[model samples]
Target: MATPSAIGIVVSDMKKALAFYRLLGLEIPEPAEGEDHVGITLPGGMQLMWDTEELIKSFDPDWTRPIGTRVGLGFECTSPAEVNALHAQAIAAGYESHKDPWDAFWDQRYAQLRDPDGTVVDLFAATP
Candidate 1:
């Protein structure tokens, strides 16, 4: 069976994107001059890659950034405190918190924030 692997994200600027993910406590590999990309190891060993426009355009010529609209990427955490901590980290890293971390009606602690490219990331912790 084929195992699930990395998710790639296209970013307008590599430097800004790198810094943002670094603030999330990911170990970013040193970028190579011609690479225009960086990878981060998520909590569960899943990898996430950030690609520059030039690199992404090579894959999909029509690819473009979504502006003025929310496209969220949800990340599940082990606990509510973990969710709140990540939300705090994002806010401290100079990003605006779209929603303060709070217990959801559906029994989860959740919060949202926007990345440099306008991508919203949802941090969620399941509550029993």
Candidate 2:
């Protein structure tokens, strides 16, 4: 079976991007805050990476930051209320909400938000 590895995100400002992810509970090293690239291994051994726009261009000169949410990240909260709380926390910290928490037909509490780079991040909990 082919296993998923890392997710790479190219950002214009490495500092802000690292800060945003750190706010979400990911541990980002202080020194990496100013680096051109940074990454961390998640629980399942999946790596989440961030690279400066300039770093990406070194390989793909025509690369551009894609607009809109073509790909997204999903977070599972411990409870339905936690989903709402975390969503609100993210918003309070200045991230934009894409959708407010709602009981979805799929029997889950769901919400969406745009990260610093405009990537959609989903928060959910099993509601039923």
Candidate 3:
């Protein structure tokens, strides 16, 4: 039987991204001294490896440069307040909001933001 493994997000600045995730309450494992990458363990043993261009380009010949895009990652929360709080935090951190936090007909409070690198991040909090 085949199973899904871990997911990796390539980052230009590992330290900054690690700190951002840490702000979201994800436990970032200690980086090996002087290492360019960091490992974070997600629930269910999923490992997210933050890799640098030098590392990824080592494997691919056509490796260009790292670029953040409008396309973003999504996260789920427990309550609308949590979503609103995260939106506020992201905005306060200089992220531009694509959508203000509001309840959706789909039964969640949802909002969007652009990360430091311009990656769009969507946060949704489920309703009771």
Candidate 4:
């Protein structure tokens, strides 16, 4: 069986990428500037890896971002309040807001934002 271990994200700015994930509770260390890649395993045991654009271009010289949201990622917040809080923090820090926090029909509090590279990041929590 092939077990899923990690997700790879190619980013334009490593610093901003790290900061965004850090704000989401990932304790990523600050690497010396311009490191090719960095990663952190999540609480659920899934590793999230970041590769700088330069690193990707090193191998795939023709690599380009897919049109539209290439990949969607969701983080499970501890509570609805936490979801709202993180959403606001990301927005205030100038991240793009795709959706404001709200109670969804699926019974979860949810919000969405775009990372520095414009990846859709979702914040969600089950309704109490």
Candidate 5:
């Protein structure tokens, strides 16, 4: 069996994408700005990588942007309040919110936001 090592994202705007992830507490290095590719390692040793669209086309000339949401990443917050706070912070920073924070029937406080590349990012915490 193969182990998954990293999650890769193809982004149209590197700066904007990096900024959004940075706000989420990812420690992407500042020097990654303007680069064609960038990445950061998560706490569990899994890597999250971002590559510019042009970089993808450089090798795969037939590459095309996917329609709608092709990927979704879920982030677990320490508490329900943190979920709401981060959701509001993301929105206030000009990012798009897909769904406001709410208590889900599944017993989690959840919210959704769109990354710069239109990826669905979910924030959640166990409801008390």
Candidate 6:
């Protein structure tokens, strides 16, 4: 059997990437700021890792960044209000907004934003 253990992201700027995830409530350590590779275990024991472009190239010399929306991560907020609040917070911190919070036809208050490396991040909560 195959088990998924971790999700890894290759980022161009480790500092900015860490700050973005921190805003979403991930407790990345301060000392990881300058490292080429950083990993943090999530609440459920799943690890989230970040590696610099240079670090990835060191092992896979032929590696090239993917084009357009290679990764999408969805975060479930406690409520619709939290979804809106988080979108605003990310924008205010200089991250890019892909879509404003809206009541989606699928019954969720959904919003989207791009992380420092342009990865699509979604914030959603059930709407009453």
Tell me the whole-model lDDT of each prediction, alpha carbons only: 0.71, 0.74, 0.68, 0.76, 0.78, 0.77
Instruction: Show model 2 residue runs off by greater than 4 Å.
Output: 32-34, 70-128
Q: Estimate TM-scores for all models.
A: 0.46, 0.50, 0.47, 0.51, 0.53, 0.52
Better of 4 and 6 by TM-score: 6
As for lDDT, the candidate ahead, 2 or 4, is 4
Lowest summed-lDDT stretch of 10 residues in model 2? 1-10
Q: Which has the higher TM-score value, candidate number 5 or candidate number 6?
A: 5
For model 5, the stretches where C-alpha displacement exceeds 4 angstroms are 70-128
* Model 2: pairs clashing at backbone N, Cα or C within 3 Å: none
Model 6: CA > 4 A from native: 70-128
Report the C-alpha lDDT of model 6 over 1-128, residue by residue, as the tens digit: 11234566878888988899999999988754468978888988776878788886774477578675334466777889989998999999999997788887669888878889877677878899
**Model 6 alpha-carbon miss at residue 98, Å:** 31
Top-scoring candidate (TM-score): 5
- After superposition, which runs of candidate 4 have C-alpha atoms over 4 Å from their true positions? 70-128
| Model 2 agreement with the true structure over 1-128: per-residue lDDT tens digits | 11234566778887877888899999978753357868888998877877787875664476567775324466777889888899899899999997788887658887878889777676878886
How would the candidate models be sorted by lDDT, starting from the highest?
5, 6, 4, 2, 1, 3
Which run of 10 residues does model 4 get worst, by summed lDDT?
A: 1-10
Better of 3 and 5 by lDDT: 5
lDDT measured at residue 113 in model 1 versus the true structure, 0 to 100: 80
RMSD of each predicted structure: 12.6, 13.1, 13.1, 13.4, 13.5, 13.5
The TM-score, computed over Cα atoms with residue i paired to residue i, of candidate 2 is 0.50
Question: For model 5, how does the per-residue alpha-carbon lDDT over 1-128 read when each residue is reduced to its tens digit?
Answer: 12334566888888988899999888888754468978788998876888788986774477578775434466778889988999999999999987789887669887878899777677878898
Relative to the true structure, candidate 6 has a C-alpha RMSD (angstroms) of 13.5
Ten contiguous residues minimizing lDDT sum, candidate 1: 1-10
Residue pairs of candidate 3 with colliding backbone atoms: none
Candidate 3, residue 46: Cα displacement in angstroms equals 1.5
Ranking by TM-score: 5, 6, 4, 2, 3, 1
Scored by lDDT, model 2 comes in at: 0.74
> Could you give candidate 3's per-residue lDDT for residues 1-128 as a string of tens digits?
11223455777777777788889998887677656657766788755667766665654456566455312366766678888888888788877987788777658787767667666566776688
